[model samples]
Target: MKQGLIILGVLILGLSSCRKDPEDPLHKTPSSYKPTLVDPATIFPVGKFGMPQLPSDNPFTEEGIYLGRMLFYDPILSFDSSISCGSCHKQEYAFAEPKKFSTGIFGLQTGRNSSSLYNLAYSRKFFWDARQSTLREQVFEPIQAHNEMAMTLPFLAKRLARTDRYIEYFDKAFGSNPNVFDMSKALEQFLMTLVSKDSRFNGFFPGKFSLLSDTEKRGALLFNGLVDFDMVTGLATGTDCFHCHGGALAQQNNPDMGGIANNGLDGNFTDKGYGAITGNPADRGLFKTPSLLNIAVTGPYMHDGRFATLDEVIDHYSDNVNYLSPTISPMMAAHGNKQLKLTPQQKADLKAFLLTMTDSAFLTNPAYSNPFKK
Candidate 1:
């Protein structure tokens, strides 16, 4: 009888040990936990353009987006945990840094201006030089760049593994034992959710012309090349801007539509732009044409961040264009040595038109804001 009682007690002890504790870090998922799968298309609808290109292997989920949002705002991804992806890409500035060049983790400045983060769902190429082919691949570049986050994938993975919250998030986001690929996918999912189609300019496309002021309306026409000013005849015609920055997204939709252009920023190919990536001389001085959305807030324009204001940008196109570059776009060449010669009123109108592209809702949306801050 004594032996049987001892055996029963031992059995009970073993069973209790096998039972997972509610607070155990490794077994954090509760019995009620269920994966919440979310369709990326539902959150980011296809507007005038077709569906956003998403990787089939890494479809979005509520859990994944949550994890990605945390990672994006967390300084843990940086070498010293002092800077985050959000450091440069602030939500209020349309996910663009206000500075001409964003300072990195170690106070090192980036080579190019930080581009805005909206409407990336329509983009096939990433970055000013169009070097990265996909969004997921692009996420890793800034994290590993010496002047940026400067953290290795292996180190990041190990550091994340030590945190119980991160481990739980990883498990919920990418099943057990999440790796760097999982982290990148989560970041990509969050970024894909940043859609900016509700701008005032969007109203004009839907026949709501009243949304724009008179000055802005004229500017819109000039920007889309609906009205141009002939240099020699002093007559108004198309500005010829739609050739590079057109479509519903107000940026090049594909490579065939001149995704990158020399833009006549410089007479000499000092930075070499896309030519440096492809090692082709003809591609020199060629840089990707960024979207005009939120141009009012995303100041210090151009690849090198030379123009500090929209007025300066307009002045460059109006009176000063570098035609000496070998790879200057044919559309720009059509203008020849003659400038657009926009009048003062015309320039102001154009600036007003660009301001209408600002999506007030996107700039203040809590979802895109830093999660760490109260």
Candidate 2:
């Protein structure tokens, strides 16, 4: 009986030794718990765009950006787990899809064209209708849109908490359990980092005539010149594009000028655009004017994606200004209700200048690409 009791005690001791001890509070955080903050100056063109007005609450961090990128490419954010934000906004097309309308959850169509995502940090307004005021709020719209992601916040929170990677990343990025608020801040951090300033248009400046071809030079002249008629050809030498799309950023960020305008796509409003949002009739037909940084690729232009090609777009401005539209842009109506009537050569030149805005680097930058893809 004595030997048996000793043996039992030895067994218990061995078993207890093999079992794990209680975890230390200091070991709770991973040894790699370091949130490297990203400098806004490194990503933003401070000298050119005057340092994009970033959200003070959500400063850029490497971990947060990576987390947001994973979320962007992850379809799990959607109701059916089918499409992600990246699905509508592809990196190859400067984060703006080539399709006329974006296909959302259950293959439903979005109301407007997928706006290109870049240089957005510089602009205060968002969406083609300028509905949202900030990127964090903007992301929630598509995620919950019945026709888009069709996701509910409660479900999204649960799904995010369910994922092990999100759990780890959420802790690493925000030192919190997977939650929707941090998710939005992470997304905002990533979206604002998408800066597009490497295009040829950004490099070309005064006395840089050699940088452009003769045709492009003429196009540049026409693009930047005032809306004055040649008197002989009854065509404008200058298209006066500066009124709306002017600036080193190739976009007017000011709300009064190029931030919003009605390009006379229609005299009557079918969508009522910003008007619907503000409940103001005067704001009807107005849409956010996106930067021309990647104009060549971000085609199917306008709020409705009406103009399929640049030629069609030019033709509308040159020959089809709808002055009869009650709320027509004062800048557009300033043309004396007459068309610019650009010549064939002039149109080609204008197109050439516009093509210079395409930044191939921005299109293929792996940083913005889908992290899931090999």
Candidate 3:
């Protein structure tokens, strides 16, 4: 009986050793498959945004990004085959819709406004509430959301298998058949490549005050200066907009460093923003602070999309802050929680400064455009 058991164990070991990974030619991946490698330097502006932490398991390839792009623009990813990721996230509006709530499959509306997609490689947390930590994992939520694409993994896998383009791309990009794991990696590669560096603000950053117009220069002062109100007229001497939305990226990267906070929007816990994710009372009303890079186009601001225009947004910070909010950020509570109370001219100057952050090149980049549209 011992001899028979030993023989069975050896047989099992032999079979297991012979099995190949999905990358192997024996596992349906063609031996001829050789995806074109993409240099990380070309995709990332390391000097500007710094070299982002990349996924070691998935390297960038031309075929992989191309496949991911197709997946992004393809309506077939949805349950009813009615919408694509690009539907809500239009490039013209900096990948954010102008609406308060994004329309999903079956005309269902999303609870939160669609976030602008750029410099995503710099963001540590995904979504307004900071629920997800990775782009690959984050992609699944929208696809599976009942109001969104509403796609089942099994159904999506089978659907991809049936498509000729997906089959060819899958083999060329990942050296495997259609699968969700590789699909996400490909999407990650494509998403990581989206870099927004060409903007008036980017060009004249650091201490190049000579490059900015007079109005913009004054606005820059208000933005970066500390919050100080004038003794007379009650106007703010400085608005101090840089605490959260600071640095060249115009946004804080670390959650502890103001990447996530309650901006004194409300005193009540109606939404419970980040608190819903952590189940912590202290975190209630706190939300992720987005980069101000494309703020000009990416409005209906805030997580719930309460403010419609940039004017409204400025008004909130200038006068409408709810300092009494239970989970308000300490930064906001600093200086006795005084409102900015910027004058109309100061508000216009600040708005002028914000408009400079818009990257027109990023909005019209053909590389990030729809593959099917062309």
lDDT of each: 0.82, 0.87, 0.89
Cα TM-score of candidate 3:
0.93
Among residues 3 or more apart in sequence or in different chains, the pairs in candidate 2 whose N, CA or C atoms overlap within 3 Å are none
Residue 219 lDDT (model 3): 93
Superposition error at 222 for model 3 (Å): 0.6
Candidate 2, residues 236-282, lDDT tens digits: the string is: 88998877888877888777785788878889999888888888898
Residue range 249-287, candidate 3, lDDT tens digits: 999979987899999998887899899999999999999
Better of 2 and 3 by TM-score: 3
Between candidates 1 and 2, the lDDT winner: 2
RMSD of each: 7.4, 8.9, 2.9
Cα-based TM-score, every candidate: 0.88, 0.90, 0.93
- The parts of candidate 1 lying over 4 Å away from their true place are 1-33, 226-236
Candidate achieving the largest TM-score: 3
- Better-scoring candidate (TM-score), 1 or 3: 3
- After aligning candidate 1 to the native by TM-score, how far in Å is the CA of 330 from where it should be? 1.2
Candidate 3, overall lDDT? 0.89
What tens digits encode model 1's per-residue C-alpha lDDT throughout 166-214? 7788787776454678788889888888888778876576446677889
